[model samples]
Target: MSEPNEALRRLLRESGWTLSQCARAVNRVGAEDGTPLRYDASGVHHWLGGTIPRGQVPRFIVEAFSRRLSRTVTCAEAGFEPQSGQPSQQTDIVDELIELGRYDMDPSRRGVLGATLFSVTLTVPDWPNVAGRLVAVESGRAHRIGVREVDAVRAMTEELSRLDDQFGGRHARPMAAAFLVNTVGSHLRADASEPVRKSLFSATADLLYLTGFMAVDEGLHGAAQQYYLKALEYAGAAEDHLTYCTTLRGMSLQAVDLGHAKRAERLADAAAAAAPAAGPRMRAFLAGQQAHSYAATGSKHQALTYIREAEVAMEKAEARAKAFGSYAPSSLAYHVSQVKYALGDKVGAIESLKESDRLRHSHYRRSSVRYNSLLAERQFELGHLEEACSTWERVLDDYPLVSSGSADRKIQHMKSLLRPHLRNPTAAHVYQRAQDQAESA
Candidate 1:
């Protein structure tokens, strides 16, 4: 171990608390936030001996000290910036997101991924401010974006969405990133009429959402998060409340995928609060996401409540003519399936997904197969091992044709699920097939 951390030791001494007490406080704080720190006196002893905590631990420690001292304290003041660099402060996040966008557009650069800490603490600061923050619009530029250009961007986004649905983000991301760099980025700075500017901002937000989604496909989660934040910023600048909340849903989706259910629920709840008057489809979508977040974090009551709310909202949406928009209407069944599975309603989840599979767009074969594989896993969990193995037959059929990181993960996990049942004939056959498919992939 290195020498004692003078900064942290000084803070401990000034606070007049034993190291064990500080550790317990940090653990309590972590538990309230859905992160079980399990810190004890020994952990504090290590921290004083220059051990830098990882993930959200440093943030929790700072919080613990801050609460005890009745003053703000940052990680750096407590000597916790070595493993990862200090996160960009909340006030500087906008500029940081912009900088992140530039890094993303640079093809030669690779943003953070794999073992890099995702500070849930750093993603959204001052949630209310972000919800209403109005970014400054520049007055003049060499190029003026008009209605025609804005319309063109919207049309392009729709076509890109179709392609992303049919193929995958792997096929469409380069173009989306290039569009942001070549067109949307410049348009944001160009002078235009108020209506045109707002439309352009809205279109840019749409483009950024696509860019962020594609980043997830590429497994650049950190960069994807930054893009979503910038998208929300532009959406707010456009005064488009629906788009802003929509971006929040995207962020929440990523959070759930990353296993940060607590943060996911926070973003989802914030979206629900901000979009009280969104159209039925949008409202249904937000409600479904809340159900997903709640389920992931084991909040069964909250999850089930939002699940019914989502179903009701979607029924209301379908009663009217589908509104023209950039988003696909809420797939209530698909979203609900996730919640059902999380809540241990496995049969319910499978039934919901099967229903969703029927109504799903033909263009999204990758997602369909992925959902089927999930259904199979639930079957396996419930002791129908042979049936579960057979269920994957369709997945393997489509697996070769599709290119998706998410799909790949599903297939990989499903393959693991088969290994335990390999003594059975059907399981043996399916395991061999999975092995062969892996080689081909």
Candidate 2:
């Protein structure tokens, strides 16, 4: 027989919820995750008495407590073992990636995955831990792959990235997930010459990174981190420093966006440390993120120093025709705006954001909506009601064309911010338009 779940009992007591209330909270979380459960007081009683809840019930319980306590609660902390068949730290990266991608591809499973809590305490493998660690698959069904397969994967990744930029991840992520499951998974298992194998891994790593970026765009932070970890694993296996560092930087961006400044700073610093030999553009990219994160953490001197470094590297980078990833002048400007805002220079941040919008590429429709909405919010914060309304109108112009969770969140914020100012004609008009867009959406 299982031992009594003393830890869970303690947490339950701390929550001050009766057994029935606890069961109802779990049921509510399950319902939100699209897995309706009729759990009752008996279920909580059994769990408290050492009975293990089956399937995803433990996760639901953990989430319920987390919501009540307003903090993360791990399975171990809740006196539950890790779920059977769930990916663990010891799971094979390739197999785990395939499973994650397949789940992402299935519409029915997507809701549950989307409801996953973004753990601030997620363990990320360092460069030394994962570097060159991938072992060859010894399956009898493993086939041979070549340069052709590698090129095809890279081309497909590029096309999906373009689609993500033009529309949003909501429209492109499913296709990417399908490709990862049906095509890239097989390629990873296939045998290849040493050089071809490394190239294939590198290409696959890039695809994983893009898919993770799309997951972030969809507000699937937990899923995005899983995809990014796989990308780092693949990049490390391939000895691809660029993708490894880039994936870390992407995670930092996600953390900062979610208001985890210290975690973001640590990740940004790790990205910079991992890519010791990065070029000028890559340096600019990494330093720009570091600046924003540091500023967010209230490190004024460090933030200014890193931003200066980014500017110098960007100046040198512009002399070359080739770009490193998508870290253009526009992206740099956005980082500058973030840093300025973090340091309390709201006006400077606005001006920098305007510069970013001006320099932004035409294909970045999703970014336009997200950033313009941010600009409008800042404008409203500064009492520029009419100007804020004007900017929000611009956002609505492109809002219908984009399908991004981040953009949707910004529009929601616009409505809340305009509520008190509804007496103003422009604010009332913008709020109505946003309402119409939300209903239509």
Candidate 3:
């Protein structure tokens, strides 16, 4: 009925385990992971008979296989789709966020962290229309929230924002997630009045959005996707249109990074539409995102058009610092690199990246490493192997300090690029050093 579950059948054949045994293993694994699933021989037979299990069963099945094989086994390979469908209520989104953080904390379930693709759902969440009441504050227990409390959250965000620049999300993601779980989680549901609740929502939205960025840096795109969506839902609830638009831009950036360029362009455009009267900083940021997506999609004309528009907006911009980071000259240079690379102007891309390097922010070490890796690759592309190799050395010096999946990718890519040049002593040394780094980590 459902294509005979051939993928699952194949995996089963390779594992050399009976369906019943697999069922027991899966159920056991689920219990260990805190997801109590009740599966047995019949359930396994049904799945093999083309009845795909729903809920978290798919994840459990994959995890079971991962344990048995001593390697990661993704849900897709087990013929399972992601858990989908819009969460019905605002509280549901909050609840989901909390669970996500907990799951992230579990080292056993961390294999699911670097999910390969993003789930696409662009339904403008209808959360705001459903309810107008805030959760009741606990009597004598709910922390009294005022402007001061909100400002404190903002201050914390600003500091972490700088750290995220200097060290990278690998360095900051756990703290952000812990902050969400330990501090922000209770505030979302714990009592407050109209104005206070609104401010709380807005403040939490910024932190959640940053958490999403942290997820991105860790190469957990699916986690980032949920974090962004939940932040957007919070923004809508807060009536913070600017944050809503900014969150949308963050979502667009994630999609582009994941290579869903068409959807990325759509998301970027949606951000602009959400805040048609946004200030120049956001306007330039959105335009730059749009241009990158266009370039990715090979729409050079539209890409260049948006590029000019972004530069014009940047020129008119005032430096307003927020949790999103101040829009410095480096930001524009970063966009220029993307645009030029997309247009097949390798040399121009390299130049833009180098300039951006000078203006780069403190805590964005992951992006710094990533873009520099790009710059090195570009240099290699232009037959400047010595320069490229030198750049690799510089990035390698910092790579071990950050715990970013994105940075992991850049390092791995750098290693691959060195493979062809093993004849060169410098490249050989870097390659051996990468091996040592991998072994030590």
Candidate 4:
């Protein structure tokens, strides 16, 4: 009645894993996702013999192979049919965004969404392909909207961003997702004047970008990419070059954080190319990211050139009275640190990171935890055990206040790095304190 899964068998052969091992890996992924399964060798055998695994098992299987092979493994590649209810390429952007938001807001679905694998081979639509391509969503009961609605969306986005900065995405993202599903979706489907409609699209794009950024802070990389793609669609539909380029740049940040250097370089360059008329501050923001991506790709000369451009742009830009989440001197410093580290200048990286921390704003508590932990790791690398311990203590101080996946990872890494040095009194004390914090968390 069914054809054998030759594609999956091929991937299984490439993975060099026994049937039991494959099943165990899927089960492990399920457990991590809080959807524990009892898959076994027989399950794998049946899957390979043409029996389709039901209810998210296929996703788990693909993720397991992706992990083993260190690359993405899609369902089609594994000979599985597309799951029902999953969005297809032909789905409208507004509908896709609403679906993503709804899933993100639901507690039962959130775990599965969180476990979605970040695909390195994801196809990114170019500016030319997406620009001004708004699909009209006709509704029979469309309500009239105006400038007030646009302003309200903008104000809410700003407030959510502030909360994310003060606490972390883990605390703010749910509220943002709920807002997107309950309020923004209806607004998108409402009738409006041409100018007001475009303005609404631009404002909503900004909110989507911020929501994606918060998803990244929580380590939901794949879900973040989905949010970013929707943001790009909306920004392009609005013909808003600034937000379009900004969303691309945000996607680049996500790729770079996940260690996809070449992809990051491509995205950063695309962002720069898309916004030729960007202001000094935006240029600095874009160029700073370009510098890090270039350095990560081993293009030292290009990296230095971009970093210099960013520095010049920063100097030319006027100071903003309220630059909450805007790119500033500290962000540039962090980029410089990343470039220096990538180029084998560890001491230079440390100095730049210290400068970044000093220049950082007080509201960015999550950033403080992440960057300070990075500083401590560099210090440990340079054999400054006591100094590293002291830096880690600072991280612990802020760790309790921020609920960020990135910060959690940094603390976990700190513990791992201090293991060999635990014989030292300072290292042991810091390790114990970190252990206690982690347990409480």
Candidate 5:
């Protein structure tokens, strides 16, 4: 292997990932099409030094290198021959879709795909701030779909929604995000008329937004920010105000998560202004997000005021029209309750949480809220260490087999915060047990 390629290979191994793991990332494309590519360790070793593999396999090679490195990598970075110099190739977009699919699913893979020699040839500009204009849309027209047949982007969006609800964001986000970058992105690149393309654009925007959502769930806040921005641009292009509003709300939520209270508030306010026609549910969700921002800033009065507004919005949403399918109106109670807790209104927070839990469907995947963990925190705060420990243990057992990033971190954070409160003998015993489980995991 040449120097650059050898260095690349060594880096991959040192990262605690196997060659097969890298190969599997690329195989995401092959698995979808039933024509998996095979790469041996030796093959990887050779490719690193500047040997380009034959056929569409190069795309996978780039993807694998990127995932392990946690950065965008190109075929050239891995010492592969430039994509343009390939001897022969198929123009079918499906093959390209496969390549994209592999890249988007994993951040490391995305870095590689982004750096691939052939990327510039793809010619789609960096995803815009919001989708372009959406003047006319011919929904369900075969002429617009052309030879490159598809199941319609909306179908894919619905699939993502179902997965999110059933499996939780942690379990299902990566694949959903990949589907957008690969399949949906492919359709957007196809040669369709303006109207047909507008519909396609809107669908693509939704997928991108969902992809960002998944990224946030996975603890990739920076990547999630970029995806949300791209989705916003696409949404603007689609001339879909609702989608744009939703994207803005997503951005605000992310800001809140990162502790940027003021920015979150501004974004939420902007969303509320832009989405006048948005259903009550959408409006309520935005308001609740704003409430979170206020609470994070320690403005108890403002937070309470926004919470009331959110409640009003939710009631109006439930009574006015129920077609706001993307987000549930009733979730306001849950969010407001959380803000209250953050502001030290423990009693109010617990009450709101109970209401939210009742209204929340089992499929809503509210694992991030960790109400039980919060309950434990409240118990500890009230001088009930034994009850807190018992509560935490129950939560640990509830999802024993699951290894969700959000859940695990929440547990760790809880344990860290309660360390100082372990003076009670029974509490100390429980804390020691929790500590053992955490360390073993």
Candidate 6:
């Protein structure tokens, strides 16, 4: 009873139209327009199982159904809720957005969105093709200044990153986005030298990437995907290899989160190839990303291979050089552990995470949030009911908004693991306490 299917059923029920009737209507209209659309009751049934329709088919479906019922159609109305549950098998706005983000990360992956219909899930109203056609925009004409202003823009970008680290990205993302669009964007259009212009674009792209990532963390996925695409364009123009690699990694991460493991792996591989001369830290980051992709695809051997590669790369990275915005060894290890956990190697994941913590003395607030969830997972897997509950309690206290994908998934898994233990009074007490703390927090 997925929303899309339910919505289709409701439309049929209200309109008193058979599934074949709706399908015929869509096909007829599409044929007239030289666009083919095909669907039936079986299709509707599949959509109910969370299948996403693709290309103009979704719009065709909406229009056909709307015409029949004398009402409007929306993705949400059709039960294609974005980010509320498992991704639909049919392509929708979510699929387009994620694909757009991935495409932006690795420009080599770019293609007509329509062609990806069968491969993608769900339909999105605003596709990436629309974004690609948009020209570079300079909304703030008066903000234009000379090369001297470039330094100011770079500084502002760094300051924003600092703020994001201190306060969560959610709190700082809007301000950062505004600065990129208003300030750094203006600099890009200013009368600056080629070098200064390139620098400005890179800075702007980084800011945009940060904003998009923060939005992703906040579950504003479609919006995040759009932002990532824009950031990728800026990075391409700047020819900044590192920023480009990071942007692609961001896209890969989003794809993996959406369960598009194959796409994620392709993106990560492209990122590594793009930055062949990447520093140790950079290589480590890309390798770790590949590891995640492998794990998600259920390729245990590949996951471990990339994880080990990341470790080797990090070892060769200079400590001082790492200060200049490189992902540390510990950070890479943390990523590796995430992959292991995804592959259900709980013991291996826990050991890797513990080792990562030991090496990477500094903890990212964002990472700490993920780590706490992971620790609870490890405890749950080990059958330490009370310990798992206590671990979750600590996580709740540390990061209250633990309802995002990573945290929510961990909680769901742990709950399933603790179901049998719930009958025990002691275990139940701890679990309830943890749940209450999590809910209230």
- Stretches of candidate 3 off by over 4 Å are 1-93, 108-117, 121-143, 323-325, 439-441
lDDT of each: 0.74, 0.86, 0.75, 0.86, 0.62, 0.63
lDDT string, candidate 4, 204-311, tens digits: 889999999998888787788888888888888889888888888998888887777888999999999998998888899899999999999999999999999999
How well is each residue in 1-441 modelled by candidate 6, as lDDT tens digits? 434466666766877777677668777656533465666667766765668876556655665666555455665676654322222242332233233444333324322221221122322222222322223433335554655686676667667666555445655665665565445544555555566666666666676777777666655555566666666766676766677678778878887866668768988887787787988778888999999999998998999899899889888876643222468767787887888788887888878777765665433555565676677778777876677677666655555542344455455555666667888776676567657766775
Best-to-worst order by lDDT is 2, 4, 3, 1, 6, 5
Worst 10 residues of 5 by lDDT: 118-127
Clashing pairs in 3: 137-191, 164-363, 165-362, 165-363, 165-364, 166-362, 166-363, 166-364
- In order, what is each prediction's RMSD in angstroms? 5.6, 5.0, 8.6, 4.2, 11.6, 11.3
What value does the lDDT take at residue 226 in candidate 4?
Answer: 85
Model 2 TM-score (2 dp): 0.85
Query: Across residues 308-386, which tens digit of lDDT does each residue of candidate 2 receive?
Result: 9999999888553222255889999999999999999999999999999999987889999999899998998898999
Candidate with better lDDT, 2 vs 3: 2
- On TM-score, the candidate that comes out on top is 4
Model 2 misplaced stretches (Cα beyond 4 Å): 1-5, 9-73, 80-91, 139-142, 318-324
What lDDT is reached at residue 314 by model 5?
A: 76
lDDT of 4: 0.86
lDDT of 1: 0.74
Q: TM-score of every model?
A: 0.77, 0.85, 0.77, 0.86, 0.64, 0.65
